[model samples]
Target: MLHLGKPLVVAIDGPSGSGKSSVSREVARRLGLAYLDTGAMYRALTWHCVSHRIALDDAVAVEAASRALDLELSLSPDQEYVRVAGQDVTDDIREPAISSAVSAVATTLGARTQLVRRQQETIVRAGRRIVVEGRDITTVVAPAAEVRLLLTASEEARMARRGIQLGGSQSQEQLAVQVLHRDAKDSTVVEFQRAADGVLTVDSSHMDFEQTVMAVVHAVLDAVGGHRKNG
Candidate 1:
């Protein structure tokens, strides 16, 4: 694999259904870097709380759960897994039930603090050469990253993409709850709708998947210099 001589931390932040997860994973694969889906960490935490019947509104309980979260997730673009307390929750965390409750856990201030620390530690463990994507990655988790990007799309486009992503199972109302409402709740804590200073924004409202990916890749190359070679 090709490698940059120095650490190349690519931090990407965006709202729900904004293609942050898929695009960041592909960007990491293309750049030969590790991938960290910080949002999944929140989802996993939500799943844990729901499984244990912990009240999502109970901030103290949620924060305690965050600090004690025994979460193991895949850090590679090629593999996809999330194990919470040795239980494989890769598919469990993506359920609609978890989606509806994730923002509750994510927006808890104390919980966010604990998770952000874990995410930062994960970056250091990866030698700071990873593509991290989430709601607050660019601004909070890795503000000093070499490349900071905000991948976004129009709400309609985002909902459409999310519907397709979920295999057309969710109704329009369900999509609105999952995509728009969740964004609204999460935004109370993280400013992901607007790009922060020095953060590049790529609006994929009218762009296809390949086009959007190339746009992000171009932005990375422009910011960091040179195209990454494929292995």
Candidate 2:
């Protein structure tokens, strides 16, 4: 599971608001590896579509934009940026306007492929250790990854976390409805992946953020130990 010289590649996947970002960041920090947030890639593309007024339902136009994208994802202790071509559009992608339409753009097969291909390319370049986190990393982008984890939470908890992030001081009554709607759509994705297997799963519905991060970090370290013994 964990190999020392080969680089400890950790893949963390799950639904939205499941603390994937925080967990992945902490795991990468503790392990001293780079962290990749694949969700931000989707959000960056979604931001592009909105900025250009591309029709969310028009796959052709969306694919064209995706194909032409020169996006960059950078994560540091102090800054995270999703760069579109040359512009840093991290903050732009998180606005409420982009959030409403992101699922539509993200769920499209063409859009996902466009982003996933780039993500896999980044893995090839990491060379050493890396922690990649996103909804599809386990099932798609990093299927051969040594350490895979899926973190999930109840719909109620998910919505509450998202609402707090949305405004800092806010309520989930509105976000919860949207979260449920997202779940309904994402169910189809799970069904579509019926043939997938071998992903370690975690239900963080009742877990605090620190607990969630520790769980994932421990999993990665355990895997590294096994990787060492195997060698």
Candidate 3:
């Protein structure tokens, strides 16, 4: 069972195309902890927008819709998925249209606040033993987390990984440009920047997905210690 006040919160934060989501999920599985893909929240919001024919740039409307979102973020031993108001938005969120626009959807204050509150509520309610993957969880949502790791990869390497994940023959350069631009936006947005201190930054540039997961999991567990210390 997931324990509260569980002492260890593995907050895996990184840029868009970095190995944050996949590796963090794997790490949580091996450790038998809950995993949350916050980026998928944004993607699902993007899907909501697409479904409603809303203007992607309108932050007020987006935030309103976000507050009304009946969203669920779920993790099991075998798979991860997200549903908005009981409908699966998993595949819909990964569409190129949604991928290109989620940053705008996520960058707003309303969106961030909504998600951050949900994030904090979930972690604390779950007793703090979870692996949360996102751009801002370490710096913003889970700053008090016992263990925070920044997973980063070289631009080329990240692009290659994204291309593989997105589809074959897609433009890595274009995706890289978008990812870098999103990074710049996220880090420089004055309020939503990186955590200044106490973040274990791990470079997954040269590591395979499993290798990266193992390294990060080792570091997080090493810091927190098993068998429930502070919880």
Q: Evaluate all candidate structures by whole-model CA lDDT and list the values in order.
A: 0.92, 0.76, 0.77
The numbered model that scores best in TM-score is 1
Question: Residue 217: error of model 3 in Å?
Answer: 1.6
lDDT-wise, the better of 1 and 2 is 1
Quantify how close model 3 is to the true structure by its C-alpha RMSD in Å.
Answer: 3.8
Q: Write the per-residue lDDT of candidate 3 for residues 1-231, one digit (tens) a residue.
A: 234455567888887778787888888888777788888888888888878988878889889888888898785535867898899877888777777787788778787799788888888766677888887777778888888888888878878888888776567556865677767776654332344488888888888877787788678757865443332
- Which is the better candidate, 1 or 3, if ranked by TM-score? 1
**C-alpha RMSD for every candidate:** 2.2, 3.7, 3.8
Sort all candidates by TM-score, best to worst: 1, 3, 2
lDDT of 2 at 224: 58
Off by over 4 Å in 1: 1-5, 227-231
Writing each residue's lDDT as its tens digit, candidate 1 over 1-231 gives 235657999999988888989998998898889999998999999999999999999999999999999999999999999999999999999999999999999999999999999999999999998999998888899999999998999999999999999999999999999999999988888899999999998999999888888888888887877755452
Q: How far out, in Å, is residue 219 in model 2?
A: 0.9
TM-score of model 1 vs. true structure: 0.96
